[model samples]
Target: MKTRKEKTGFRIPDLSRAAGPISSIVAIAVGLMIGFIILLISNPARALEGFAWIIGGGINSAKDLGNVLYYATPIIMTGLSVAFAFRTSLFNIGASGQFIVGALGAVLVGVKCTFLGSFQWVVGLLAAMVFGAVWALIPGLLKAYNNVNEVISCIMTNYIGMYLVNWIVKSTVYHQLTNRSLPVANEANIPKLGLDKLFPGSSINGGFIIAVLICIFAYILLNKTTFGFELKACGYNRFASRYAGISEKRSIIMAMVISGAMAGIGGGLLYLAGSGKYINVEDVLAPEGFTGISVALLGMSHPIGTLFAGLFIAYITVGGSYMQLAGFVPEIIDIITATVIYFAAFALIMRNLLQRFRLRKGGERT
Candidate 1:
């Protein structure tokens, strides 16, 4: 029977487990196609060259790869933040607020508490996590008890956090000349952990390792623990979880808190890179948080997938910068990123279509 089936035609592969990854790949391919079309319209003569750069430019040197890792670190944390909340059946738009608040807390410690010695950065990270958790807790509380929508509360908090940071920075750690927060203490910079030697002039640091470890930890927590199971159960059906004595309200609140803490740590990692970057007292919210949504969606809310998705975005960003050499402005990269994000939002639909196709194929074979 198997030989006869093979002689007739190739069998349709099982797509049940593979649907999510396959859809994500399709989304990426579509996004890239659209980006290439835009490039062709803008600069027909160099469109192919610019496209090549956008695809493989990040591998040109060790420094470029290192920079990709450096940039991926923070976004990975934020991606994990979004992914965690998503798994818990919650939307965490407040990641931006949590991130900025956490950054401020780290800065306050890094600047005012130099007496912490070599532990300044460590304390700063802890402060950032604490601040982020507290910031998220407000929305979690409102959502759990008052039946408030987290989206609205989160949006309000983003503006509040941005303005609050601006005001506080000017009062406490303001640098009059630069109009930004003061530089962190020398010891407050995250350790390079020999990444400087490995990357040769790249800003990569131990923070990348931290980000990777967190990803692994998150994967394990979500896949191997009873608590993780309960959180997911609540997400799938809160009333059912409650009937099972899972305390859905507690799970909801904890999920948001954990998500916020991750976002906060991301802010701390970015600012403490010791790369001479300082927090600007700007009116805009942190972009990393919003980008996290793209990463989570693209990764299908899988922790490991989110890590790779973050790296892919960073790789594309680095490649886009090189597009200038190919007669294309770097802003084209933004168009590409936006397009990818737009397509990523359709991953679920793609998955469903694939599953339906698989079912039809199975029925025919039977």
Candidate 2:
């Protein structure tokens, strides 16, 4: 019995996962480096000067910061819109259509109604939300009941919405009076929030505050509500959720409605912030909706993350213009942003590889 002896030892291997937000930041940095390198190959001197100019222009003053926030406002809303649907494993590819409908609804109310002051704004905002929700619901219902692919349906809807809004503007009294050729009414104009007084040249407005509040509210709704839990559960496993008595159809519809409402509110707020007197269907559709997908991914589908992503994108955009002014290609920012998105897609692959390596190492040690 005394001849037997045994010992036990343990080593604490790294148990932490890569910080997702930090990893995203690193990816962005890598993207920027690549962008700069590409520029260097073409024109080293201008590239260097352009980089400096971008940094300087983006943060040169408070007004610059305000402008970034201003641009961030709508994207934040649309990002939330996309993020909401993502939680239910649904891709809301129709945010562009919903956004247009929302703007059209709000503009119609804003111009046609004689209600002045705060009531006009409130009514207009509500109208936008209602219309936007309905617009999204069409595709949601189609996917739920008809088994139609939301992606295709949403894209078709986007085109239809654009044409419809354009026709409405042309035929309605809300048509622009400015040269008698313009298509939007002056009465529907969004009043400035005195940002002009604070920073005369900047387009910053109260909409920024509204965007932040909406983000906060969305975070709370998603994390602290029963409905949010249902949405998440359905997204995780629709079959399992259905077996557990969750109504898949209802969840799908609700997700789309909520998503559309967020986008609509964003549209309304953008107009209210003095971005435009009348909503231009084509102007708001393209980059706003497409960029939201990037924002949603970059933010990791979190409201706070979306806010930051929107700001980052706005920074690069505004900065890129400055770079162009300084004799470098402004498209540098676009390249960097696209590269970051591309790299972000590999995050899951990177995580799996790391896990496999860890497991293999553990097996050998044992």
Candidate 3:
């Protein structure tokens, strides 16, 4: 909760604030324990090797680590989107919709606008934020004024965005025979920022840097500003916040809009990064958005914590892809992830237990 601390960079500063990180670590450990049980049943012989990879795959090489960063980039944004809205007691479930719309905005700009060098990505990214904000605005307005349930509106908007963007791609920028949007313009592609040299031909790009900066920004916004104070007050109790003269409606709307804009920028950063992946006519929701929910939960909706959670999730995904080496189905990774989510519920329990034990130990020492 924003009430937990004031402006203080990344440090937790106490055991009380350490609960979130401790819970996340517990979740990971429990998830891995479940994974081991599954592996024991499936293939006891190769289980150890597979588990080893799951834990250490990201560091196998520079390329592997780069892949982790590439995967983390979008989710980091999406995670922040979810976290930011949550701080204001709003659920921005439309991040998927915002993400797709943002992707569409970037694609449109990439195809139509021509900017010099890296600035193209800048323009496209801004367009994405605008598109995403616009897409989320109606839902925010409905939640603010009409008292509509934000989750329902957000879900409906998500599907609408997905279908609408798919249609636009098919009609405007569909790559012939590829079934995907056309490649972004050369200028629109995200700069390597010298990472290409380090990873030596990986998907790593400037997006990672942007994601980190944004996470820090989110931290600052939530902890250091008067505006953030109002949002958090609203989140803690809208009735009390309203009584205190904080306009709950305006805070809710602004929170949703900001959350959506973050998601949109994430989509732009990802597609514009020159990854082979592109938006297509698929009816499927953007996986990155949903994955962000898990990341937010794992991080307990903390910006700095989300960074580690995103990276951890991305790391496991890369490691999971290599499960075939141990003669296991790669889908096992999904099972592990699901189990992790399931285990995430226990994080609070673990935290409570830790708290009790710590108190008891203190009492004894006293």
Off by over 4 Å in 3: 1-15, 115-118
* lDDT (C-alpha) at residue 96 in model 2: 82
Kindly list the per-residue Cα lDDT of model 1 for residues 94-188, writing each as its tens digit: 88989999899898999999999999999999999998898889889998999899999888888898899899999999999988999999899
Count of clashes, each model: 0, 2, 0
Cand. 3 TM to true fold:
0.93
Residue-level lDDT for 226 in candidate 2: 88
Ranking by lDDT: 1, 3, 2
What do the candidate models score in CA lDDT, each in turn? Answer: 0.88, 0.76, 0.86
How would you encode candidate 2's per-residue C-alpha lDDT over 122-187 as one tens digit per residue? 777788899889989989899889988888988888888777877776676443544111333344
lDDT: the better of candidates 1 and 3: 1
- The lowest-lDDT stretch of 10 consecutive residues in candidate 2 is 1-10
The candidate that wins on lDDT is: 1
lDDT of 3 by residue, 139-212 (tens): 99998899899999999999999999999999998987878898888889888899988997579998999999
